[model samples]
Target: MKVEIWSDVMCPFCYIGKHNFEKALENLPFKNEVEVEWKSFQLDPTLNPSETKTTVEYFKEKKGIPEAQASQMVSQVAQMGQMAEIDFNFEKALITNTFPAHRLIHLAKKHNLSSEVEEALFEAHFIDGENVGSIDLLVSIAEKLGIDKEEAQKVLNSDTFDQEVNQDIADAQNNGITGVPFFVLNGKYAVSGAQPVETFVNALQQTYNETVSPFKDLSDGGTSCDADGCSI
Candidate 1:
């Protein structure tokens, strides 16, 4: 079975959803048969890297929420992160564009290191509070995942994965996906948001059970009609 996840690195729920999904996968009997692919989705493509605001400040300004309320909102998210054992440092999070980070993910997919790269990027942005838009930072993250430094640097330096990243976004749009942490199983079932582990497990189990490996013969071929003759 193949699972495609549409997510953004800056999304807090995406990070939590990953953990939940992994836990569900661990409980699956056929876990080894599952293939997961992370697709790119940018929460804010128009964001400027030069902006120095943290996530809290960005929410305050953009959403017109009070500073305290913004902080409270982040605190609520932190509580959610705690449930998944994720330490979210939203106070220090850099509110920058994630297009470059998404590009790195696409590059990692070619090397079969997409999962590692996605985890590192999520940890960098949500936990370590690093600027994910920085090419230097993305290259360093890729290198840490055992990817060739030169290859990662070259891809980052140029717009090599730009089209692929955009295509992922376009595909998500075409699929009618309006949010992050969207999980599609076998292109037939979709589970959206940071659902509980049981939800994921049920989806997985349901998909597995509903799958018919071989067609069942309902009746014997006692009589059949052909172009030549009909058997009675």
Candidate 2:
């Protein structure tokens, strides 16, 4: 089975969903047969790359909500994060454009380091309060994943994977996806948002079992044995 996840680096729930989905995969017997791909999405595509503001402030301004409401929203998300055992420091999160980060993720995909950088990017943005839009930060994350620094820098410095990043976003739109942490299984089954681990495991198991057909019975009643008795 193949799973494609649409996520934004700065999306708090994406981090939680990623961990939950991975935990689900770990419970499957055919986990090794599953292919995981990280697709890009931008939560705030129009935000300036150099903009500096706390997540709460940005949320208040963007959503036109009051300060108290915005703080409450962040608190609720933080509570959800705690349920997933994720440490989210949204108080210091900066609202910056994630285009560069998404482009770098595409670049990392070439080296099979996309997943590694995705986790690192989320950690930097949500927990460590690092500006994810920084090319330097992204390149450093890629380097830590064993990706070539020059290649990563080159990609970040130029529009190398811009098209790829846009393509992922376009694909998400084509799939009617309007949110992050969206999971598509084998291009067929879809699970949205930060669903629980058991939900993901059930989806994975069902999709795996569906590889074979379970046709409806069409003939006269067939004889079958049950735990209670045998049909004759």
lDDT minimum window of 10 residues, candidate 1: 208-217
TM-scores for every candidate against the unseen true structure: 0.90, 0.91
- lDDT score, residue 42, model 1? 83
Model 1, 152-222: lDDT tens digits are 89998889988999999999999999899999998999999999999999998877765635345688767
Pick the TM-score winner. Answer: 2
What's the true lDDT of residue 87 in model 2? 81
Q: Could you give candidate 2's per-residue lDDT for residues 1-232 as a string of tens digits?
A: 7899999988888999998998889988999988899998998788988876899889888999999999999999999999888989998788799999998888878888888888889899898999988889988998888988998898899998888889999998998999988999888899999999999999999888775543655798888999999988
Q: Rate the local accuracy (lDDT) of all candidates.
A: 0.90, 0.89
